[model samples]
Target: MSLALNIHSQRFQLIATAVAASLVTAGALAAYNSVSKRERRRNLSEEVLRSVSNEASVHTLPDYSVYKEDASNVRYDEELIREQLARNYAFFGEEGMAKIRGGSVVVVGCGGVGSWAAVMLVRSGISKIRLVDFDQVTLSSLNRHASATLNDVGTPKVKCLERNLKQIAKWIDVDCRAEIWRKEEGGDLLEGVDWVIDAIDNISTKVDLLKYCHDHNLKVFSSMGASAKSDPTRIQISDISHTIYDPLARSVRRRLRLLGVTSGIPVVYSTEVPGDVKLLPLPEEEFQKGPVKELGFFDDFRVRILPVIGPLPSIFGLNIATYILCELAGKPILNPLPIKNRKKLYERLLRDLLHRESKLTGETINKLPIDEDDVGMIFEDVYLGRSVIPPHLVPSRPALTRWILTQPLTPENCVVMEYADAEKHVKECSNPTIHPRDIWGEDVNALVERRSEEVARQRAPA
Candidate 1:
């Protein structure tokens, strides 16, 4: 009787436990559902709010097929098109397509880098653009520019690009400015525009435009000197402030620093300084003294005569385009505008790796050459409220390479018994990496000068 009573009590206990577990699970599921529903509602409300806030009304949609036949007429490689579209769908979604069709971009220059950048923008479905340039197409410019052709030799670059962009998107609203951008003219080139692309060649002119764009709170992406460089892999999307060694970047940073601005404006620039010899038209006396004082801005864009017109600029230009697409779609590729390097973490890892390797190998610790300026400055900036590394002077190879080698390696490139690759090395040595694309500013005046040039593009209202 006692055994039967025990068994019955045990069965009752099991039943009660199972019932309790089921009730708890059901409660959790209910809570989860409520939270999920709330989140969904919030997201929908936000999307509706955004749609309503946009100047281009959510009601008036854009036509995409206006230039489809024209693009088809260009006979682009079908396979390549598929590959690019598939890879970049994140930047060219249906909504992005609508934005491209409805939106407008003011291209500041129609030269080498700008020409291709404009072309990529149009091909990516941007229907409306204002092409601005003060110069006519030159034979020399045609060598590296995409908007120039034999028939376009004497025509203004803005006009030629406009014609091409129109051919790609027939209904694209195009404005041609056959003059430079200035601050005093006080036109609406930036007004009612979605974004700006800086492809201008002159340093002073580019600086003025950047100031205007910054002041107006317009999104702008500027290309630094792309000439006289051979390594396509080195070209990257970095902040004008973070780019290292290159003359154009240095000049840009100097200008920004002079203006007392912290940071704004995304840029595509290179760390590899141009190493080519140029014919400088300096004062006759100055020319004879030494190889004409290397014209900093001019030297930055000078390229060596190559055996073939290589894919370096084209590839870099394409990368710039990809970043731009990311900006336009509101889905950025690298954020905080231009990517900032994590020098501190890199240093820490190198030191730690070196110390560990020395202990294992029973050798004296070798001190890695640390830049007194960089080490102290980087640490203080990150720790205290000191300014971050100027974008133009961001550490690249040689300096970076020196810093890395300070860590003791086991003869091989291994990081002291670790299987860390280059990417892993960077990851291990970085602080929280923020998307570099969101570094837009409310005050455009800080970065760009308005109406400095007499001629600016003007677009008719839709």
Candidate 2:
């Protein structure tokens, strides 16, 4: 019995020794891996520093001391940047990637839309960028901002973007400007850039920036309203003149036209009509305290905030980045499918309108004052593919009808209505005793009058 016990005790001792040896081996391996990782990181840092030093003699590099622990030894890791951008290289090819890498972009307004755009542009092989913003990162910005954290609140938005962007691509050159973009100083801010992205939310500032880019003949892409928009599918890229349903676009288009810019600029806009979403109201006490203009950061800047669904602005930014990248790579989006390739629809509408006008006037009319393009603008832009009547319902059989029979069928006088509504309007207008305002209410008349003014403004000489 004593001999059996001794053998069992020896077996237990053997098992314990094996377990201890296994634990020791695991700990040693873990220590080795940790040391190796640190060594690898240190080596990479040194390599990047050396590469940057070599490139520094060719051209001046931006101050990157803040990003590195060893501020004296700043670096550019070409191999790392290349590895990071391998996918883009694959897609754009060597020649295209060369252009993309060489291109520089300036983004105004480092908010939700601008932040995401700047981030992606840097990630997509754009090595140089200028971030300009007068505002600071707010706690509220975390919802849609690409990189802002709780710690970034109250800091200049441009600085925030610059820091985060440098982390993305150590080789990237980011010019951070924490100042408002005004016409007087825009030249200094915008000079020496390949492309300018207008993401300013304030209307006046946006218009000024666009006009500056237009006058200077800079290749500029603008982002229209993303606030109060939720449907990502409805977002589209089109010429500024073709944007519709977005009040911000309409205002910008009108202002641009008055400034002698009918349409050469490209804009990203949403067709989703803001149903009932309104700007957040200010507190009653605040309104009573003083003039509302005093409440704004700057005069004429918006005091009330627009409600934003987080994802919409990011989508807008993505679209902007994608477009600019393609253009820089010499592969422009010849035709964005979202901007409906429906020339046939426009032509059919024009034909139907001409026939209807002839029938109503009892004369064989060859043409009207408007063409298919004008009809399209009236149908899609002005009327938003809905009847101009009460409730503005989308009709099953929509037709373009002359609003006032006494007046000629000009773009301003045209309106979209159901076939039945058009027939009713024609019948009512046939009687000289009845005025069109009497048939459609004063509210409708007011709306039509506003639309007419808008159309007239658009048609005015640039």
Clashes of each: 40, 0
Distance from true position, residue 260, model 2, in Å? 2.8
Candidates' C-alpha lDDT? 0.57, 0.83
Q: How would you encode candidate 1's per-residue C-alpha lDDT over 90-125 as one tens digit per residue? A: 547767655655667887877777778788877776
> The CA-based lDDT of model 2 is what?
0.83
* Pairs of residues clashing in candidate 2: none
Number of clashing pairs, model 2? 0
lDDT digits (tens) for residues 1-462 of candidate 2 = 455445358787898889999999999999999999999999999988887788765577665464564323556567756777899988999999999999999999889999999999999999899999988988889899999999999999999888888878778888999998999978998999999999987677788999999999999999998877789999999998777566677667877887999889988999886555445556677657445442111222243366788899999999999999999998899987655645566788888898998898789999787776577668876788899998899988889888888877788998999889988999888887777789998888889999898677655432
For candidate 1, the TM-score is 0.52
Question: What's the TM-score of every candidate structure?
Answer: 0.52, 0.69
Per-candidate RMSD, Å: 22.3, 12.0
Report the poorest 10 consecutive residues by lDDT, candidate 1: 453-462
